[model samples]
Target: MVTLQLRQLTVPPGHRVILHNINWQEFEAILTELGDHRATRLAYSQGTLEMRMPLPKHEVAKVIIGDLVKILLEELEIDSESFGSTTFKREDMNFGVEPDDSFYIQNHAQMIGKERIDLKVDPPPDLVIEVDVTSKTQLDAYEALQVPELWRYEAGKLQINVFQDDKYVESDISPNFPNLPIIEAIPTFVEQSRTIGRSAALRAFRNWVRDTKNI
Candidate 1:
């Protein structure tokens, strides 16, 4: 058997490693060992642990989508607390996931001034955004954690999944932004940010929202 520390293992971007038969104790220890400052993301469920590093393009999309989401909330005068990539885990459920971006909308009041989260006591984030989630394990982790709404950006398209009946059902429109055309605007602006510049795209998005609000 080979002995390696978490620090010794290197997971390249756009790739992941899966380990099975890991228990809850080991998962917590691994999280402690890995520490909070790192580029890797982890998803653990039912003794299976998967860790991966996100690519540059993946990061770009994450930031753009997250920014647009903030803009939407601001334009609509909705109060929200943004917890970017916070690690949410629970030993009881044996589920832990670190999303690219997380926001507290419906439950913003409870999360105010809370730097950390305890899923057993604290409510799961209202909206979570991730990039290129091709694995069922990640989705399973989110469902187990009982997050109300999840946003996934992949292949230049946005997928909104709502939790119901203990499962995730894909929906065309986000429950958080029901009246707005977020399904189209989110992706359009994210892509626009890359070409026209992030600042320009953001301004355009804000203007679009204000225009829509008046109509």
Candidate 2:
């Protein structure tokens, strides 16, 4: 039998590798080995584990969307704590995922001084953002964790999914920000970032959010 160490494997950019039948202990060991400094993204469900290396465009989009969300919260005077791609997992449920970005809006106070997320005791993020520049998103982990809301950006569009009755259903409105047209407006700003520069696009988005208050 041929054996390969996790370190021996290299997932190229814009690609993903899947390991099937990975037991819980093995998953923990692999995560420990990978450490917190890596660039690869991960999602584990049941006995399957997936590792993906995001494209450069994917990196830009997720960060801009995260910035937009924070802008929205600030403009509205809504307190929030953003955790960019912090790994979230539950051993009892056998599910784990690292989102593109996450935020604790309603539960920000509870997470004020927390060093790390322990899903068994801590609440799942109020909102999770995923930018699918390459692979399709695996929703099982988010559902298993009962994340209240999700925003998925794909093919230059944003789709909001709300957790309902133990499952995810597409929703036009984000419970966190129901007043704005997130679906139509977010993609525009994200696209603008490519042409006008990130800072300019973010500034435009911030201005737009502030303008919404006047109406």
Candidate 3:
């Protein structure tokens, strides 16, 4: 019989290390041990686990994107709850993933005033934001968990993906915020934030959204 060993290695920041043949029990233990360490990201599917430490550039983009999402939600008067880097997992599906940022938009009511979220009973987040500066997204794990929406930012562009029939398909617009030009507008604002500073760029974005909505 071949038994897989739990191996550990040290890698540079933003590098991903794969742990092979790890079972659910061991994976849960590892997650518990890594608690509250916000810089690291973990993804697991079947028997494969991936761990990454995001670089500074990656984190900057992640924050800007998340901030923009919240700004849009607020300007639209849409209720939302942001969960930054929260680990979402499902035991029965043998999958687990942590998004750069996640939000409950349409499903915000269900999460109101709750201290802990259990996917087993509670509804999954309506939107998840992923910033892919170097690594590709682990879509298989998200698919297993049935997350409804995804926004992926890579190479200065944002792509919207909607989950349907157990798969994710690229979409030009978000179903929840259909009128907002999310794909085009977000990346543009991200660039503005980098050049003019986050606060100024955010104020401009809010003004733009208000004008656009009113027109």
User: Each candidate: what lDDT?
Assistant: 0.89, 0.93, 0.87
Ranking by lDDT: 2, 1, 3
Query: Residue-wise lDDT of candidate 2 within 70-117, one digit each (tens)?
Result: 899999999988888999999999999999999999999999988899
Local error of candidate 2 at residue 96 (angstroms): 0.4
Best by TM-score: 2
TM-scores vs. true structure, each candidate: 0.96, 0.98, 0.94
lDDT of 1 at 121: 92
Q: Model 3: per-residue lDDT, tens digit, 119-202?
A: 999888899989997688998878888889999999999989999988999999998789978889999999999999989998
Clashing pairs in 3: none
TM-score ranking of the models: 2, 1, 3
**Any idea what lDDT model 3 has?**
0.87
| 66: Cα error in model 2, Å | 0.6
Candidate 1's residue-wise lDDT over 134-207, tens digit each?
Answer: 44337888988999999988889888999999999989878998888888899899889989999999999999
Best by lDDT: 2
List residue ranges in candidate 2 displaced over 4 A.
none
**Residue 4 Cα positional deviation in candidate 2, in Å, after optimal superposition:** 0.9
Superposed by TM-score, candidate 1 places the C-alpha of residue 53 at a distance from the truth, in angstroms, of: 0.9
